[model samples]
Target: MNFIPFLIICPLTFLAGLVDSIAGGGGLISLPAFLLAGLPPHNALATNKLSSSIGTTASTVRYCKHGYFDKRLTVPSILCALIGSTCGAHLVLLTSDTVVKKLMLVVLPVVAVCVLTDKKEATQVAAFSHRKRMLIVCISAFLIGIYDGFYGPGTGTFLLLALTRLAHMDVRTASGNVKLINLSSNVAALFTFLFSGQVLFAPGLAGAAFCLAGHYIGSGMVMKNGTKIVRPIIIIVLILLFIKVISGN
Candidate 1:
């Protein structure tokens, strides 16, 4: 119940939620904040999941309320994400962090270029058959869900990109779908940490309040501005991820 950790975590969590709500990669900020505040690594990761899960729920509801989510893809995507994330979590136990970090170093730049070079407008949906799109979406969701569970720095950004570029969804709809998928993964992880007693509820709850505020505002901005807001934030998140990987932090 230290005020110091609360002070450090809450503000950054707000910032993290804001960035995450818009373009993903909030953990690049929030997780580090928890560590900086002196939480042990396990507790920091656990508490981060707690706060982020709550904040993500708010964003997901907001996106769905705005009719940005695709009902047809919802159940399948969530199921795939759940299964993938569970597998990913287990995979992490067998994998080395160094391997993941090295892979990200190569992957992040390519992702950034794709986001930058993407000329598609927020409202422009790509042409793809419904069945084909469903296949693409579900597969992407499952694969990215595993990445979320295994490495998890920019899962939302990756999902957003996949939905937009691969599944041919518009930015608004893709963003919403990303939120839903991320929420499932986050909640799954949160429960694991919660059951294991790694979550620090006092700070986690406090951070959640701030995170909720951030998500509300950020998602509102995306709803208003669409791709103009999202693209830049995504680039920024990519840059942050790249730095984190290279620096090995």
Candidate 2:
């Protein structure tokens, strides 16, 4: 196997990690790169998760150290995400993914539009009761975590949006919560790939080291600028994912 391609992939993983840590949708960059690198689909996915989990773990730690994480909320979401990601992984083995791809094609652009049109200024328009919000978050995390395990792109953005819109967290808090859940989902997927022995370790580790740099930069940026930075990055990532999904067709 040619190792030269990885020289480029590592930096891209770094950039994607930075962008993903702040907003979401790192796979928009990494996944296509993997596919182009000539790995089989399953191996590409399994390898991506191996690298991605490390990047996300780094980001999660950064966010935690910055005191942005809410353990009460994060703990529950992490538990739910673990369950959701495992279910999603198993479900993919039994189901056709064509429909999910089609749905994502439609839904991603719509989500992009909403982000584009959203008004400036953070608002807590979240009107759910505490009990209701917890329930919604649990369900949302579970579903989205499954989606992450199966299809894998845009999971962070989905979690952030759900928390901001449904659970009434502001963008900053939503990001923190999203990171917690994402960490769990990535860990769950990593376990699956580990068991299958599909991960490409050499490239994955090289990619992960670079990705850690990006994660550090992204974590600091999010902590400093709050959602002002997050919203635009998320919009960009969503549009990229939309383009990627369409291009794959």
Candidate 3:
């Protein structure tokens, strides 16, 4: 509630936004910052969703402006992300994060390794038509959406990775589409957290302003630097997330 905390958080939000816009692990910073600010766990998570939803929305707009979004494929993923977030929110209330924490330890390293080791050339080839890929993407989004709603950390990274690998899209295209899907899931989770009265508005809004700025800057970086840079950043963030999850604090 103090202005001093806002000062500390603003820069972190900016950093989170920038990294998140690039590779999808912004929560790796923001959520821990919120918790350290003395919010209850539920309140911290909900407030995080509120702040991050704004950033992701900004990224979606940025992507749209850059002419990378395909509505036909994106629309279905958005719809499923919404549904999945709802399911995930409920699951969060009922389930424990122990299993997810353990799994992340393995998954993050693997994702990082694959991205690091992958030598596949980027191609414009349509590995699957929009309709078929939509089905696969929808299912993937739904599952990840649940994760986003329940216990979000690296949702963006997972979404981007899945899109690139499973959906056979390039990194930029996947990042663009990932924003759209992430926005939907964040909105869904935001609604649930709002109804539950778990959000802390002041820090959230303050964090969000910086987050928006970060998204703008980060999106440009991704567009300019391409996946070569994005991939390593993703790996680092995921490794950070792995440590955080394993620490179980």
**What clash count goes with each model?**
0, 0, 0
Task: Give one digit per residue, the lDDT tens place, for model 3 in 202-225.
Answer: 999988998888877876762754
lDDT, model 1: 0.73
Q: Model 1, residue 135: what's the lDDT?
A: 97
Off by over 4 Å in 1: 21-24, 93-124, 217-249
- Residue pairs of candidate 2 with colliding backbone atoms: none
Candidate 2: tens digits of C-alpha lDDT, residues 1-249:
487768656776776777666545666656545554555556666778888888777767767888775566777788999999988766654544456556656755555454444443465756667778778889899999998887676787678778887787777767778888998998898787778686888877877887778777876773654446555655554565566556773
User: By lDDT, who's the top model here?
Assistant: 3
What TM-score would you give candidate 1 relative to the actual structure?
Answer: 0.75
Q: What ranges in model 2 sit over 4 Å off?
A: 21-23, 93-121, 125-127, 217-249
For each candidate, the alpha-carbon lDDT, in order, equals: 0.73, 0.71, 0.75
Q: Tally clashes: model 1.
A: 0
Task: For candidate 3, give the lDDT of residue 61.
Answer: 86
Q: Weakest 10 consecutive residues, lDDT, candidate 3?
A: 111-120
Q: Worst ten-residue run, lDDT, model 1? A: 111-120
Can you tell me which runs of candidate 3 are displaced by over 4 Å?
Answer: 22-24, 95-126, 217-249
Ranking by lDDT: 3, 1, 2
- How does each model score on TM-score? 0.75, 0.76, 0.76
Steric clash pairs (candidate 3): none
